[model samples]
Target chain A: MVDIAAELKRPKIDAHCHVRAGREEELSSQRLVEAGEMLGITEYWCSRPITARYGSLEEIRAGNDAVLAAMRRYPQRIRGLCFVVPGYYREACAEIERCLDAGMIGVKLYHQYKINDPAVWPVIELCTQRRVPILVHAGYVTDPRTKAEQPRLSHGADFAEVSQRFPETMFIMAHIGGGGDWEWTLRALRDSSPNVYVDVSGSNLDDGQVEFAVAELGAQRVLFGTDGTMAGCVGKVIGASLTEEQRHLIFWGNAERLLAAQGKQPLAKIESGQEGVAG
Target chain B: MIFDINAWVGSWPFRSLRDSTPQQLTERLRKAGVAGAAVSQIEAILHRNAQPANERLAESVEPYRDVFVPMATINPTYARWEDDLRICHEELGMKGVRLFPEYHGYEIDGPLAKRVVAACRERGLPVQIPHRIEDMRQRHHLDPARGVPLAAIAGLVAAYPDTPIIVTNARGIAQSPLWRRTELRDAAWYADTSLAEVYFQGLDKDLALIVEESGGRHLLFGTHAPFSYPEAALVKRATLPADADTLEEISYRGAMRLGLTPESWAVKAGSA
Candidate 1:
């Protein structure tokens, strides 16, 4: 069998990750970097951790502060995503501006509101104007047994609806393999505009999930991410039945290109002092 | 050589799976360096009468006994389940029996399930319970049932301590509190790596930890083949941070404890 960890020596970037402070244990920046080093990850684009309840504007600011601090502490190993709870539109817009001014590259939306909810339009419009990507928490509906009374989750179709409305904005359907409706998610994103991409994050490792995504949406549209565990994410891609070129594209190239398109530099090139190819 | 404890033949009702036929499956497994696999029939999970599926599985693997070990599925929900178990053990010569209580609409700890377990114990046959064949979330729109509950499995484990019970297709079972319970931890309950793989940082420490917790002898290597790429599971096993002897135990010896010996079971179909 191929030694995937040994063979993959290129600089890789995690397009989806979180940096948290306070009670959260696993989402700390130190933990993310420690885990990243094990999987040969060069950099990570991180968002703030969201709680089960709707966080106040002050809570969102504190989360973004942790992200910005991580980017500052590990200048070349971390990038920031200003997390927003779009229902607090005025406060979310202000926080987005504050983080973007601090050199953060994108926006991260959690389950505070649905993707298609009209309340999120201002944030979507802001992302489009700035050419930054938005990684949204989207998944299939819960099983009837575990279904909550008022589930405010977003599905693939919801992402499609938002992506169509904001054609210029790059929308990442986080965790295409997440939840029961991943197949439905992939199909919904297949015909949507090129601005939409899928991240291979989350805990669900269904067989042939990555291959199916690559086959349907093309390798360029799939980005590698570890919702947390670096080894699990790397194993998912490396153990997949993909060509070396396809593996490279998913592991690093696609992320590099996506960041570049947003006028952002991956920490690897910045740390190596390489020429600004994108610029 | 890797001996895969979980693999399937025939079509799944939900999605299109590659390598469904015996030739295709064995070839795929062989290419991935898997020496042999214990295969069950997909129809058994969906069909009301598991006898035909078991017979079909035996016939399908008759020619390839050198590489395929048939594991007959016995749904306790069906009538004459004991007779089915008899046929599976005597007529079909299957090395073990597999059950899908959730899919078949029977409780794992119910009387019918107990009878099936008793029969397998009497025959010295191992019982393989698939927590689920497909991810509950990813099941076909029509099939809404979830995987067999861990509590039911725990009850069954407590009920039958001597029966070699192997759980297949259970992802993340290692981290569950049930895995740590004294009743389950001390029992001869085993798990396959098909869905139990967990990785942190750059190491496959989750699998290694599972081996340590379950005793290296209690964990078996399985691919959940056809539904998953055979190489995926093989890569996980090969990459695990374990010593050669421990790896050997997980790859083959663990199943040997369940009486699935390649020497006895894999000698070209009829000559044995």
Candidate 2:
């Protein structure tokens, strides 16, 4: 027997998985535990959803707190981020400050909330001053334009602008900056502020674009992540191309530095295939 | 073992034929470390007459007989389908039959399809019916497969019960409602993992898991023949590695029980 699990056991660090503790319709907690076990990934974070009426400040607090609570319950395995609509900087700023001080490591901006908008300035300013990383939904030009109204999974250009505006905050250019095209993404990354980093979060195929990011911006800019709940179809074709070295970086290396710089222990460092060790 | 169970052999007509000759297909497979491959003709999928396509497919494949075992496509709608089948087995030396039910305007449950299936079984060949050729939303509109009815095909499996049927070009099994029915379950049908996971939905075990749970054997592999980067399938297959026994069953043993002779099946045909 060729030990298939070994063939797949390079380890994974899901830098941007959705942290939906209260929602069962999508990725439930029980399913997350099992899936984490199966894919050999122990850490992931979910972004909070932006809403229609946008809930009350307390309601927003609960949403952020709920993800923190879930991570607390499984402290040895998960990481989390508090999501805020970029359009509501007042409530988003308060939530970001509260969550960051409480030990939440990152910030998430999602659907319909344009990164280019002026309202997101407060949160961006706080992230820059505090050095908290932000993962925005950056999509390609050809994708449904409405994703901007929903969830923009790729936001490189806006990230560039924001990264330039806020030098201290580390911006993760997620999904290889627009559905895995290195050439175009490179132009965006190269043009962006040096603070911008690309996360191989959802798409882990290690395309030359990823190499391009590493080549142009250095490997420290590359982070590993899985869209977790929907790591199929996308992961299948793309995962095939990832080499073991890239897996190590995306899984935990970049994440470790990000956390250590923030004065926190990296999530259950299982490197050397050990029970627990430094990542 | 990870194998591309559904790739093509020669140049495909819808797009372009494979970039390589038959020997090139073998060389390509070898580069991926694949021991053997079960290959079909891409040109046969869309060419109105299966003769020229079949003829070129057979001739191109002759030199690499050991590594490239052929599965001839017999369009039940083609003028000389029976002749194609005969030339495939007796003349070209194929060990299986592939069907394009949707493209040919015939149902898998139709009488001509049964005749074709019977001809294949008599000659100890496994029948291959692909569910689709191109991505439904991505096809160029000039040549699009009408798409087969998965339920009707399931019905055919229920009727046959004992016959071996392999569905290639298999994708979107998750979206199919027929397999979800609690009242009906067909144990005889199987599928190849082509166009299976283009969505990154973690649907790797989706169809196979369903088939396996339903007491069905869903053969897992890729469809790389004539594809631009045929090695693309190899990357997809790597995400899905079966255990030794499961690999034995899918990569060869199970196909043998379907009536594929020892001369053509992957495991038996080569040291791989």
Top-TM-score candidate index: 1
Task: Let me know the DockQ for model 1.
Answer: 0.27
CAPRI grade, predicted model 2:
incorrect
Question: Is model 1 an incorrect, acceptable, medium or high docking prediction?
Answer: acceptable
lDDT of 1 at A153: 71
The weakest ten consecutive residues by lDDT in model 2 chain B span: B196-205
lDDT, candidate 1, B1-272, per-residue tens:
67899989998877878788999888777766787889989988888998898999999999987778889899888788888888888888899989888778878889878888888888999988988776665556677547887777778888898788888877666565447566667777888877665454322345657766555756888878888656556656755657888887888877766767555543432352
A83 Cα displacement, candidate 1 (Å):
2.1
Residue-by-residue lDDT tens digits, candidate 2, B1-272: 33445667655443444335667666655655555567777767777787677778777767766556677878888687888889888988777888887777777888988888777767767777777664332234465545688777776666665566777655556455435543334455566545544223332345445544642255545544445233334433444444456655655556556544335444544665
State candidate 1's TM-score. Answer: 0.88
User: Which candidate tops lDDT?
Assistant: 1
Look at candidate 1 and tell me the lDDT of residue A183.
76
